[model samples]
Target chain A: MTLTLEKSPLTEAAYYILLSLYEPMHGYGIMQNVKVMSSGRVNLGPGTLYGAISSLLEKGWIISAGESDSRKKEYQITEFGKKAVDCEIHRLEELLANGKKITGAKQ
Target chain B: MKHSTWRWISDYEKEEKWLNEMAAKGMSLYGFFMGKYTFEETEPGKYIYQIELLENFPTSPESVAYLRFLEDTGVICVASVFRWVYLRKEAASGPFELYTDIDSKIKRLSTMKNLWFTFVWLEFIIAAANLAMVIYGWLVVGQMAWFNLGCVVFLVILGLILLNFGLKPARKIKSLKREQLICE
Candidate 1:
């Protein structure tokens, strides 16, 4: 599938969310995982996370895995989300390689 | 202590800011109806309030599910009136925000604009109907012309007020769109 970063660039929060959902996780669990994965650089506020979750769900990139408890619902990234994440990774790698070449980081 | 306060605020920012300030002053909002707000005295600066403009409340399944999701995320919904929801979280809970990104904020503001736009059109229709009735009273009925004209004037004023309310959200939505474009 043709992938364009302009058409599907993942927000920092969305990227981390997809990463966290490699395994099914509840809302709070996903939040904790994102924080750990980002090394405390990204803190997902409840509102921000909720918005990302809703958008991802609407795009069919994520599916509800069911309730984890009496209160929280669980979610997992779909095959669609996995492909999107792969595209984002490639885009980021290209950006990094181009930046390193221009800046003479290895020279 | 429970105290009832009456306020007529059409702007969401102003209303939310006012509620937060009151909370900072030890007044936690309990509920709201018509123009009245019931506040309960509590520890000063204990809670932060966020106001959400819902298109449908308490009836729509989506609205109910949205609220449930928010609750699962630890936000407390204190009250809802018509299409407005008053939410609160502890002051120590980081921040009480409903729309963290510009796009989500724009969406929230757009909902408010839509609601107000509906009011503006409905009021316009009512004002036009009242004007027609007033004209009929003056030309055909030849009775209570002054009373009918008074009603027409009242309807026109109400329509103007609703239009003003709609304009506030429209401006907010415009600024949000501009910010999003610049960020991109």
Candidate 2:
């Protein structure tokens, strides 16, 4: 799957959300995971996360992993989603590497 | 004991802030219908209140799913007025917010404007019709033209008021888009 982070980077909310949904998880689960994964630095509001979920679903990066009898629906990342995350990671790493190289930290 | 208060705030953010202020003052909003807000006494700052304008009726399956998702996140759906949903969370819940990112915030504002765009325009339409009635009565019919003139006056003012409310969010969205551009 071709992935691009060329035009606009994913919002910080969407990035953390996609990362949190490696397993099939519901909204609350994703929220907690993002908070923990970000070292308690990022907290998502329901409205923001809800919008991100809808946008990601529309883009086909994620799919609703069949709702259980439980009322809370779960979502899982598709292969496309994994590729997107990988692409974002590559972009972030490039920035990091370039910063370190210019700062002469790479001796 | 429950007490009810009336409000006519057009801006959602201002309405939300007023609800939070009431919560902070120890009267928590439990329900809202029309322009009336019902509150029950609670400990000061006991709850955090949020309000959102859903893209569809609150009873729709999509909105229901969204509310369920919020409920799972410890946000309770307290009341709904048409497309507007009132949410509450115990203050103990860490940092309750409904929109975290700028894009989502812009989307929220857009949805807010959409929900009211029809009504605002309807106001203008009614005012325009009344304006025509006023002119027709004064020149052609010449009876009770003053009544049509009164209707035109009232509706024109109300239309302008609602139109201003509609424009506020549009302005907000434009500035937010600029901010996103700079951040990008």
Candidate 3:
């Protein structure tokens, strides 16, 4: 589903977390993705990760896809979550283009 | 809607054993077990108190220090400070009235020693005193006095703010008590 660019409002951490879960991922997998994606600039603690996962679940942005053994549960983004991600990407591209234009003008 | 009241030691070991025994006996109990001591009205005149979760209380160095300080002070000690405990069948009963036998005013004072309450009051008091000093110095003592007063006030406010923020870790000790009471 195509998402419009107006309704995306989330913190950078939340946005990155949802982005990381494009494929089926578990808690640790998401944590690892975030670390690699940010080049270690954003290291989420276990407590914070758990809290973020719960909030995302409550918002219906993510759902438990399956469990890998009893210890680790994998999750996947919903169609709504994908739309949100698309919206954010569009917004970010606009920001980057605007920033480039401003910097080019300065030069 | 029945409840029972009893006294148990506020010490961590004894309280844990008692809670285990109570659980084993198939009783559902919930309430805080607190020990409190009021120091003499000297420079550091204050009351020291500890609340232990009857089930999983912490036995750490800081807890030991608090208990020891109470013992050394020779202050009046109140123990087995549970308000109400219920049986398993009686668990969903409504809240019952639980009163401390101590004077209400004195008990109210004890609540002030809580970190949140103390920190708020400390900030207000320091702010008020500093404002007073600033106004008084400007009117009477001159700019030098005002500058001196400003320096003292700044240091005092900064110190109190740091102390207030530092008290957060100690709040963790209270969580241990809460965990013990929470029925899981």
Highest DockQ model number = 2
Q: Could you give candidate 1's per-residue lDDT for residues B1-184 as a string of tens digits?
A: 8999999996778999999999999999989988899999999999999887776775699778777777877777889888778888888857665665676677777777788788878877877887888788777987666766777788788878878888887998888788777672
Model 3: iRMSD? 20.4
Winner on TM-score (1 vs 2) = 2
- CA error at residue B130 for candidate 1, angstroms: 2.5
Instruction: Name model 2 segments beyond 4 Å from true.
Output: A1-8, A67-71, A103-107, B5-11, B142-144
Per residue, candidate 3 scores C-alpha lDDT tens digits across B86-169 of 211121222111111122212222333353455556766776776777777777875445664665677566656656544543
lDDT of 2 by residue, B1-184 (tens): 8999898987778889989999999999998888899999999999998887888888899988888888888899888987888899999977787887787889899987775677788877888898888788778986767877888888878877777778888899999998987762
Candidate achieving the largest TM-score: 2
Clashing pairs in 2: A47-B98
Q: What does the lDDT read for residue A7 in candidate 1?
A: 52
> What are the per-model numbers of colliding residue pairs?
0, 1, 1
Off-target runs (Cα >4 Å) in candidate 3 are A1-8, B1-184
In angstroms, the error of model 1 at B5 is 3.6
Chain B only: TM-score of model 3: 0.26
Single out the weakest 10-residue window by summed lDDT for candidate 2 chain B. Answer: B111-120
Interface RMSD values for the candidates, listed in order?
A: 2.4, 1.6, 20.4
Q: How does candidate 1 score on lDDT?
A: 0.81
Worst 10-residue lDDT window for candidate 1 chain B reads B93-102
Docking class of 3: incorrect
